[model samples]
Target: MKRFVGFVKKEFYHIFRDRRSLFILFGMPIVQVMLFGFAITNEINNVDIAILDHSKDASTKEIIEKISASKYFSVKDYLDNENEIETAFKKGKIKAVLNFEKDFSKKLQTENQATIQILTDATDPNTANTISNYTGAILQNYQELINKDIVTPYQINTQTQLFYNKELKSVFMFVPGVMTIILMLVSAMMTSISITREKELGTMEILLVSPLKPLQVIIGKVVPYIFLSVINAIIIILLSIFIFKMPIAGNYFLLAAETILFIINALSLGILISTVSASQQTAMMISLMGLMLPVILLSGFIFPITSMPLPLQVISNIIPAKWFIIILKGIMLKGVGLAYLWKETLILIGMTLFFIAISVKKYKTRLE
Candidate 1:
């Protein structure tokens, strides 16, 4: 009994001493709880919305004031004409637009009814639907508030126009997200484990001793994986197109180029992981545990980043998957070209270069 108790104490001490174990036991749970608690919400707050009030009448102004005053939405832009709506959505800032037709006040008072069109970017159907519902609820409450003294109550008709996805198909949203997650996990996990395996088996030293330069060795190690990863990307694209009937609105060549860039970004990240990890198990664990949650939650795959708290929203900027997912949605749903997508493309390129530079520096340090 004494010997067994001593062994248990030793095991506990070993666990407490290892920083990685301590992090896994205590730090990870807290982080996961916080992420899940804050990021897993469906409710949207302070969502940016644009206004196009052709009437500019008292009724229109009051309705606009009510919308802007709500905790759910902020009036970001007030457009002069309908031509600006397309440009607004392409910029990816405004989520919904409130268009008050001309004669809103006249029609509401004389005919006892008026129309307000809610144009929502339905690239995310769930969010679009939620916005429509919330806006409708607000209008309903306003109608009730004003009708208490009038003999004939005024009715506000909202015609919701869902751009990009008329049917509100949930599949349209999930396909791009699934593709992003698959590519990130497969490319990063595989390359990290492959390089770490070489190091574990003592073959990396043999390669270093050869005539090949350090950069050449690293490139050679990742080249085969790149080819394989591209093929995997192609397969996923074809599946999204044929099996799911997903739309590809932008140029195929540009889409292919962006996909290749994201895959390289992921592969370079894997190489950086390999530099720090000493074994295949460690590499795999880091790739799976470290990358999975951030990719799924912080990437804005399912949840709206705008709805999240300020800290998580700021943290999401550093996530490569978040940028790639934006690129995918822009091309696939919005039919946007390079002119509109330049910022996100540049960000991925910068991240890829940074990862490669770090990996090369670490590789040289290992040589010393």
Candidate 2:
């Protein structure tokens, strides 16, 4: 009994002394809890929406005011004409557009009915459906409030039109996100593990002593993985198109180019990870924990970034996966060319360059 107690006490001392162990036991739990609690949410808050008020009447204005007042949505743009709605959605801020039919108040008074066409960007069908439902509920509640004293209750009929994905298919949303995750994880994980494996097996020293320059060796290590990752990306895209029946409305050449760019970005990140990691286990853990969580949580893959807290929203801008997902959705669902997606593309390019620069610096430091 005394021996066992002393051994346990020594183990406790070891745990307290090791910062990594202490962090794994305490810090990780706190981070995981906070991330799960705050990042994982079904409700949408402050979702940006556009309004095209054809009626521009008293009732229409009041309804718009009510929607604006609600915490769930913010009326970001009051579109001047129907043509501007598409442009707004392509710009990626506007999620839905509330188009009130002409003569809304007059129709409510005389016909005792009005129509509101709720056009939603359904690239993310869950959010689009939620927006439609929430908007409809607001209209329904408004109808009830106005009808309490009247003999005939005025009806507000909502015609929900889901753009990009009229059927509200879940696959449309998941395919892009899944593709982003696969490409990111597979490319990053494989590259990091590959480099780390060379180090672990004591072969990296042999390569370093060879005639090949450090940069050349690093590129040699990465290029095969790049080719393999590209093949994997092609397979995924083809499967998504044929097996899942996902549509590719944009240019295939452009898509291939963007996909290769993202692969390079992810590979550069892997190289950075390999530079700091001493072993395959360390590299694997970093790739999986450090990269996977952020990709899923902060990349706007499963949750809307706008719906996340402001701090998280700002942090998400730094995530390369977020920009790639935006690019993919823009090309696949919105069918927008480089004109509409130039900003995101530039952001990815900048990130890739930054990652490569950092990895090269870190690798040289490690070589020293």
Candidate 3:
């Protein structure tokens, strides 16, 4: 017990002594959380819209007033003709253009409806869709106001329930994803490179020649990382709970168990990387380039896997972070138990076993 405590103390000393590792371990989570929370928002606000009201009538004026009043859009310019619409859009200042027909009020009074064209820049499809929906809602509100005296024969109203995150804040979604990423990076990448550093520095030979078995040596190196990673995970969770107000609806014990499983999986992957890499630099590069990119891009962290290219979608299936993120979301956000996330949990377990098997095989070959 004393020896283990001494080993842990040494690990802490090594971590604290290196300013870069300490920064990455502590600073990265806060930086990523703040960046994702503020910069990567799904909410559409103050989208610049151009108005092309050819009508010059009361109805068009009212519709324009209603659109501008809403917080979703700001009227940036007025287009006199069709030629101006293209120019305004090309200038990149406007995201959408609302065009009222030439005789909007006259047509509406005579025919009961007038056509309004909503031209949107679909470069960013999500933003374009949101802008279109906002415009549609404004038009519907205007129609409802004008027809206040008339009673509808049939009315349909939708009350959408956004479960888990009632406010639909993107932070709620990003929190678990970011946590998974940070934990994976610290547990896998750093541990892998640290282990390989011993080999590169020729210290691994000295340890191997000593009384310690290969398993004990490997375990000693990894155990400290597991402890540190758990502490880091706790810090991240506390930050999310207190600072972000992220809810933890599921059992704390279950969450802890799942987190341990993920940590084990990541650490095993680190061992596999350490076995394969010839140097600390190689391990670091592979962990960052190979593991981090897939975790960020393909793990449904920043981009939805459902919307990815078919091949990339298939590739995402193998990433451990992808499954971990899903499991974390299910437990943390949906308040689901093991029964709900068992498949993903099992997959993670299987991956951990596979990685451990490969590392053991590689280690045996090195021994022989």
Candidate 4:
């Protein structure tokens, strides 16, 4: 028994000497817990949209004010005519447009019915659908408010319709999510293991001692995975088009470019994981145990981020997948180009830069 105990102690000492291994074994669990606990949410907020109020009356103005006040929407612009709606959506800055028919106030009082058109950029079908539903609920509540004082039986009836994804297909929502998962699996997780394999085999020491800079070496390793990820993304797009009958409403080139950006982000994260792990096994464990849940739960892929706890909603912003998914929905489904999606694109780019910077710093520290 003493001999067995001695062997166990020896193994632990060996493991402890490798700081990366210790971090993987002990530190990763905490990261996983925090990510899943604080970042997974199901609610949407501060959605940017346009308003076209043809009526320009007291009732319509009141409804617009109520919508503007809601946490779910931000009225970014007011359109002058129906012709401007398409142009505004094509610009991509707007998610949905609210059009109030002319004489909206008078119609509510005289005809007991008023029409409000909710025009959603349904490239992200789920988000568009949610915005439409929320608008309907808000309108319904407003109906109840005005009808409350009615001495006789009278109610303000509002008609709402969904544009783009009029069918509300659930599959449209998950396509981008699945593509993201495939990319992460092929790019980030694989890149993590590839770099750690060199570390495990001790070849990393030779490269570190060589004249080539550490960042260049890391890039060289990650480039192949980028190609592989792009190929996987192409395959996903093809399947989505041919089998799922998904429409590419925006620029195809933009979709491919954004996908590459997302792949780079995942690759940088993988490289960071490799820098923190001493063995391929450790890297794989970190990639899977530390990241998979966050990618799925916190990315707004499966669950809505807005309905989550306040802290979790704030944390969800940190997940690169969340931004990528939004970009995917925009470019693929909404057909909106860079104008509407630059913010989300910037977020992904920023994350990639941050990960690369951290990895480079860590690599230099190890060299010293």
* Candidate 1 local lDDT, 126-169, one digit each (tens): 99999999999999999998899999999999999998899999
TM-score of each: 0.97, 0.96, 0.59, 0.80
Candidate 2, which segments miss by more than 4 Å at Cα?
A: none
The clash count for each model shown is: 0, 0, 0, 16
Candidate 2 lDDT over 1-368, as tens digits, reads 99999999999999999998898889888988877888899989999999999989999999999999998999999998999989999988899999999999999999999999999999999999999889988988999999999999899999988889999899999999999999999999988887788888998888766887667766876899899999999999999999999999999999999999999999988988988898999899889988988899999988988888898899899989999998999999998999988999999999988987887777677577
* Comparison by TM-score, 2 against 3, better one: 2
Considering summed lDDT, which 10 consecutive residues are worst modelled in model 2?
A: 359-368
By summed lDDT, the worst window of 10 consecutive residues in model 3 runs over 153-162
> Per-residue CA lDDT of candidate 3, range 1-368, in tens?
99999999999999999996887788767755643444345566668888888998987888888888876788989988988775565444576788777788887676676788887654334555677677778777778788777654112121222234545577776888899999888889867886688787888777666786666666776788888888988999999999998888778999999898899889888988988998888788778866876788778676545444456668888999988887776667657678667888899999988987787777667766
lDDT for each candidate structure? 0.92, 0.90, 0.75, 0.81
Scored against the true structure, residue 82 in model 3 reaches a CA lDDT of 82
User: Model 3: clashing residue pairs?
Assistant: none
lDDT of 2: 0.90
Candidate 3 — which residues are off by over 4 angstroms?
1-157, 210-214
Candidates 1 and 2, the one with greater lDDT: 1
